[model samples]
Target: MIKVLLNGCSGKMGEVVVNASKNFPNIEIVAGIDKFPTEKYNFKVFKNTSDVDIYYDVLIDFSRPEALVDLLNFSVKNNKPIILCSTGYSDEDLKLIKEKSNIIPIFKSANMSLGINLINSLLKKIVPNLYENYDIEIIEKHHNQKVDSPSGTAILLADTIKNSLPIESKYVFGRDGFSKREKNEIGIHAVRGGSIVGEHDIIFAGSGEIIELSHTALSREVFAVGALKAAEYMADMFYPRIYNMEDLLGI
Candidate 1:
């Protein structure tokens, strides 16, 4: 059995992962770290990672950005592989994750859905060719409780497209008044309401036609399942590197 350390085990995604892991016979969550610890679903929870005594083969974190830095540090100190499913990390935090991957395997992704990764790969291949003719726009929606705007997944999509372009593309988060899109600008719009799980749509518009790619997540369990698969995959690999769900899916 693969022993797992679950970080942010009290949050929404954390709870989903905890419940899902219980049904899998090959994996076990040995310990959990969460800020708000209340007995839920008969799982033992601690307020910090230091309280856990068992050696974990992999650490899965679904916490906030504030909690992620300490979690990454602890994972590095313990020399344990980490599957970071959390979103809202700043550029500096992302740089740190890349730096830490030299010593320990770090699998990170903004969107854990396999389909979204596939979409990202497709975008990378298509964006360069369509750069001149197509005007790009990304619109994302999440639950009202999400603190960050535009969502990390949206940023990832925009960045991938931007990297593919010959010239650097400017990102316009929102527009007001009589503002018109620049030729080299990628527009990103964010919407928050209700309990929506997640949604992302990318549009490429031209003179007479429009091409669109979209992904809608009906449940958060898809992310949980993907993260578990990543943990299992990481346990079997020896190389230390940063990876995304696309690498896991071999797209």
Candidate 2:
């Protein structure tokens, strides 16, 4: 069995992952790391990642950004593969993750659903060719408690689309007073309400035609399942490399 350590086990997504692990017979979660130790689940919870003693084959993190450095440090020190499912990492934090990949196998994704990663790859191919004629916009929605605005996934989509263009593209998060959409701008909008799991839509508007691509996540288990698959894949792989859902899915 692939021993697993779950970070942020008390959080919403973490709880989902905990339950989802039961479906994978080859994966077992031996321990969990969380700031709050409320007795909602059956797993032994550690207040910090350093307190865990059992040999974990891989560490899956769905925690907050504030706790990422400590988690990354612990994973690197123990030489365990890490799958970072957490969102809202700053550019510097990403740089740190990239640097640490040299020492351990690191898998990071803003969104873990295989479909989303496929969409990202598709956008990379379609965006550049349609740049001159198409106007692009991205809108995403998540649970009300999500801390990040526009979301890391939205930025990932935007960045992928931007990379396809020869000229630099601008990101417009919101419109305030007197501001109009620029010709080279990629509009990104975020919606937070209710108990929605997640939703992302990309709109390509042109002369008389409109193309819309969307993905809706009904449950968090999709992400959990993907993360578990990533953990199993990384267990036997060599370290010092960064991977995403696409790499895990082999697409």
Candidate 3:
């Protein structure tokens, strides 16, 4: 069995993961870490990773970016692999994660949905062919409670396209009173309302045709399932490195 230490145990995604992991009998959530501890959970939940005393084979994080430092330190000290599902990490945080990956295996992804990662792989193949004539724009929607604008998945898609393009491309997030859309720019727009699970649309406009690649997450379970899969993948990994969806999916 793969024993998992779940972070953000009281959050929405954490709840979803808790519910979903029941189907995988081989995986067990031994303990959790959350700022707001509750008595309802079957497993013990602590306020922080430092307080955790349970034995876990891997760590799964779906919390905020602020938890990165402590998470990395604990994982490194314990020599345990971690699957980070949190978004909105700053460049410095990413650098720290990457540096620490030299000591312990770290799996990170902006979007944990397998469909989103597959869409990313599809974007890489098609963006290069259409980059010259197509004008690309990305639209993303999430729950109103989401703190970050232009969801990390949106940025991931934009980066996928940007990296595949022949020339340099700049990102313009939600333009207001813009003179005109630049030729070498990728426009990203965000919508937040109600309880949207998640939605991402990549629009490619050309003179005669428009091609759109879209993915709608009906529920958070998809991410929970993917994160568990990542947790399983990380459990057996002894190598110290930063891994992503590409590594998980073997893309």
Q: Roughly what TM-score does model 2 have, to 2 decimal places?
A: 0.96
lDDT, candidate 2, 69-168, per-residue tens: 8888998888888999988998899999989989988999999998899999999888878889989999999889989998999999999999899998
For residues 1-251, write the lDDT of model 1, one tens digit per residue.
99888888888899899888867789998888888886875657888877777777998998888877788789878888899888888889989888888988899999888878899999989998888899999999999999999899999999999988999779998898897678999999999999999999999999899999999999999888889988888876668899888889877
Model 1: lDDT equals 0.88
Off by over 4 Å in 2: none
TM-score of 1: 0.95
Judged by TM-score, which candidate is best? 3
All candidates: CA RMSD (Å) = 1.4, 1.2, 0.8
Q: How would the candidate models be sorted by lDDT, starting from the highest?
A: 3, 2, 1
- Model 3 residue runs over 4 Å out of place are none
Work out candidate 3's RMSD over C-alphas.
Answer: 0.8
Which pairs of residues collide in candidate 2? none
Candidate 3: residue 164 lDDT (0-100) = 94
Model 1 weakest lDDT span, ten residues long: 37-46
